[model samples]
Target: MPQPLIRRAGSADADVLTAVGAETFVETFGHLYPETDLRRYLAEAYALDRTRADLADPAKASWIVEADGEVIGYALAGPCALPHPEVTPDCGELKRIYLRRAWQGGGLGARLFGETMAWLQARGPRTVWLGVWSENHGAQRFYARHGFEKAGEYDFHVGDTVDREYILTRPPVSFSTVTTKTALDEHNLA
Candidate 1:
């Protein structure tokens, strides 16, 4: 397979972004919700207008992965919104990283994650946090592998269904302090 082209997403890419966002999201979690609820949530969350606004947001740093000229995955990190009272102004959040199932085990996710972390770290945020669905063990493990730790819990509303989510935080710059040459060079990280 041709290597996926990864790059910072621009405002003009909103349609493709919305497509991948909604597609990957539904692929991952669609069965958990009623079809009407899922459709409503996708319209509310990943509609073209909403995605265009998101792409235009200065605080949001986004990237897309494409193969054969088709967008298949995306990652976004920016201003933290985890509702913990202790979260400070300096924290940023790993807002979303959605890839088609065909792209899941291919290391594209890690590359995108690494690039996203480097971007957030460049912004000098003290840390980055993410909210993962409590039942999504794979996602929890993925975040753990990326240096995030479960710091707390929160409720996430997907339309009318409330999901229990775990809030995980990682100090973005702290990974730079490590001196392992192979580790740093081989794995893109914080």
Candidate 2:
């Protein structure tokens, strides 16, 4: 396959993002919820208007990965909104990162993550945060490899279902401490 094109997302890409977001979410976790609950969550979370507004927000950034003219993955980052008390306006959060199941485990996710983190730290170093499903051990391991540590726990709602989620944080590091190459090397994606 040719290399997938990864680019910054804009308000114009709302429809595609909505479709990809819902598809990826369902692909990854649909089995964990009932049909009605999953539908409710997708309706609210991937609503086109909500996505468009988010894309238009200057404080947030999103990227989409496309191959053969189809969006296969996406990542979103914005000002910290995790429930941790230590979270401040200056902190950044990895709000969402998803890839179609077939596209995972091929270093694409790491590339997408690297891009998101670079954007988050572009304004200077601040604590970075993300919430991951506690049961998703692979994801937890991936974050840990990238320097994130479990900082707390929280409930993440998907319709009426509540998932035990781990709040992970990467403390501010000087540029010299964690270069882009270092991040990729840690993942063996370089």
Candidate 3:
């Protein structure tokens, strides 16, 4: 069996991403959604054309983890898409990180998340955010272990099901100095 390898995705991996992403989504959350809704959501979210476009988009980055010649997990990062008012304009988002069930609990999630976080940090976003389904305790724990804190909540539409999701955020990296518009505070002092 070939060892697991993590590599950045390219346009050539669109089909692979579509397949793995669809399967992983179904495997993890299929129970919560009707088949038709699931299919529609998959078609829109993991379509080959959409994945290809994302692969080609300069604003986004996706990674694939392959083991034994099969995609076992994947991660994606890009500019913030969630419309949380607390999020800074230029904040980054850890969009998705999905792994096959057989591949979890063996330290792979941490490795994948670490890589994804590094990618987001390199993009120079002081804050990185992700949305997790409120009932997914394991996922919530996983994000918490990575230093993410509950920032806010929002309604996430999952195939017609409006699920409450917790928006978690963490600083990517600490800088030596941070500048704020303390001009207001300074003015108030005067």
lDDT values, one for every candidate: 0.81, 0.90, 0.80
lDDT of 1: 0.81
Per-model TM values vs. the true structure: 0.89, 0.94, 0.87
The TM-score between candidate 3 and the true structure equals 0.87
User: What are the clashing pairs of model 3?
Assistant: none
Write down the RMSD of all candidates, one decimal each.
Answer: 2.9, 1.6, 9.8
TM for candidate 1 is: 0.89
Candidate 1 clashing pairs, residues 3+ apart or interchain:
none
> In angstroms, what RMSD does candidate 3 have relative to the true structure?
9.8
TM-score rank, highest first?
A: 2, 1, 3
- Which has the better lDDT: candidate 1, or candidate 3? 1
Per-residue CA lDDT of model 2 for 97-129, tens digit only, reads: 999999888788887887888888887888999
Query: Any idea what lDDT model 2 has?
Result: 0.90
Instruction: Name the better of 2 and 3 by lDDT.
Output: 2
Q: Model 2: clashing residue pairs?
A: none
Please give, for residues 46-116, the per-residue lDDT of candidate 3 as tens digits.
98888988899888899999998889999988888886997776798989999999988766666677677
